[model samples]
Target: MLTIFLSALALAVQTTPVPPQTTQLPPAIPPVSTPAKPVVEADLRPYVALVTDLGTITVRIETRRAPITATNFLRYVDAKRMDGFQFYRSTKSWGPANQLVQAGNRGDARKNFPPIAHEPTTTTGLTNCKGALSMARLNPGDATSDFFLLLSDIKGFDADAPGGDGAGFAVFGEIVAGADVAEAIFNAPISPTAGEGVMVGQMLEPKVTIKTARRVPAPAEVPQGCVVKAG
Candidate 1:
């Protein structure tokens, strides 16, 4: 009787049905990404317009990088001391064609201000490259009103440049527009007997006159191909 009861209980327990269990899971999250920053460019360089007999040549002055030289050039512009200036020299035969054209107060002491301290390329990080606007000096710190515009890269004018004086010319600015005008000035007539020493054959016969020079607003955008890099 006990064996039969135990067998009956086991058969009843094995035959009985059991319910299944289900678990709840949380939803998966989507990935998030960060946005990229926009690029911003600003040209805080100062601009100056030179109205000459040939045409207007716009120059961008590196005031921040070459404060002393830039400020000295601006002093003459602000005082109208450069009104009657002339581009009287062209060194097209120096090393390469279309080398440079120089202009100033023609060494008139009355029109020139006191000389400023020398600003080397080591200090300003500028160079005597194409379209460069640099001061003319017999020696460092003697540049007064004379300035020149280059039409080709002349590394010899840079401080520590190979085969050059460690203290080179100070390049304070560059031509931003009317490079054609500068070229015309460079190709102007040269007096065979006007200048002295090495400048004898480099003097402009009739000299291109500068009508006015004044500050102007920066261009909406830097002209294409108007890139300048520090030396």
Candidate 2:
């Protein structure tokens, strides 16, 4: 009977199934991150205000591109040489679409500075577009204090422009504000028999005086290295 009992216990143990073991997984590694690029700031340009009897016309001078002309203009402003100058010429008769206003010492050699080196549009990459501030000269490198503000895009004044003088006018700055005042000056009265050559009948009878010209604060919102384009 003891042998029979031992045999039954052995049979029961052998018939029971063994439990299966679970396999363990390794931990996942995190991905590597890339570094971000740094932000760059814009380069701001200089601004000047021309307070006129009609209104104020603000301009942004391109010192980087037209250093010679722009510096010359700033010199005059700093010395107060343009304080009593006038916008004496209006080319409205050129056509309703073509217009510009001229301002400076008005041939007052006493108030004039020496002529500056010519900065052609080719070199400066500037154009005589609307609201452009360009130097007026009889020949290359003859520009003095006289300058003009365009009320229209005069591509003919661009260097090497087709059907235009090879040496175009030097554009050093652009009107940023008070273009309306410029337009008003352009539409002002003209003399019937004033001016010479093509300038005849294009002279303003009563010139618009530049009450003051000084460097004003630049707009904070304007980013640095920003290029001012014509509106």
Candidate 3:
């Protein structure tokens, strides 16, 4: 079970004021005296297939709790614009076991679209467990499309800070398949210029490209919750 500290950090990524609905359908008419159902942490069955130079890894994401973040990611996947994007930032020298591996080029000033709000780990009720996929951001409110996959279950990131609620990173998805493939990327030699000070040379292969990120419709009626069952 996820601890309160971990859950609090996950919610940080919950979109503030909530993003305008991504759906095209009209909003549900409010019923007089009917309080809105409290939002629950969602187990989004949204799946992403990352085709990297080494191999492919499939991830099942939870969207119920982090709807905005999930929707934003699906938008990119649907657009088929994730091809050839690179994981420009790799910070392995920090954290336990030098455990972080981040990737997201959808925010490159020249290649990325407009930025999205920061999704702190707190708001989502998720945690930085092993193989967890979290968004990468320079600061709160600047996230675009970059993300990081945890090699080790680092709990230090599971909290909200004053500036961003410590909000750490938003973990919206988990690697359901191809964990070995992810590790291949994590264990790949770190290049000298993968990231700035301390993180430099932390990339497995500085030139390793994500190649493509495709979205496949999840199986129908999958349970929508935050906890991922062991595969």
Which candidate should be chosen as best, given TM-score against the real structure?
Answer: 1
Which of the predicted structures, 1 or 2, would earn the higher lDDT when compared with the native?
1
The worst-scoring run of ten residues by lDDT in candidate 2 lies at 222-231
Taking every candidate in turn, the Cα RMSD to the unseen true structure, in Å, is: 5.8, 5.6, 28.7
lDDT of each: 0.87, 0.86, 0.69
1-231 in candidate 1: lDDT tens per residue?
999999999999999888788888888777777787787767687889999999999999988879999999999999989998999999976868449898998746799999988898888877788889998898998999999899998778888788888898889999988899999998888998998898989999899999999999976666633224533
- Candidate 3 at 126: error in angstroms? 0.9
Candidate 2: the clashing residue pairs are 42-224, 43-224, 43-225, 44-224, 44-225
The better-scoring model by TM-score among 2 and 3 is: 2
Would you estimate the TM-scores of all the predictions? 0.81, 0.80, 0.68
Give the distance in Å from residue 23's predicted Cα in candidate 1 to where it truly belongs.
16
Ranking by TM-score: 1, 2, 3
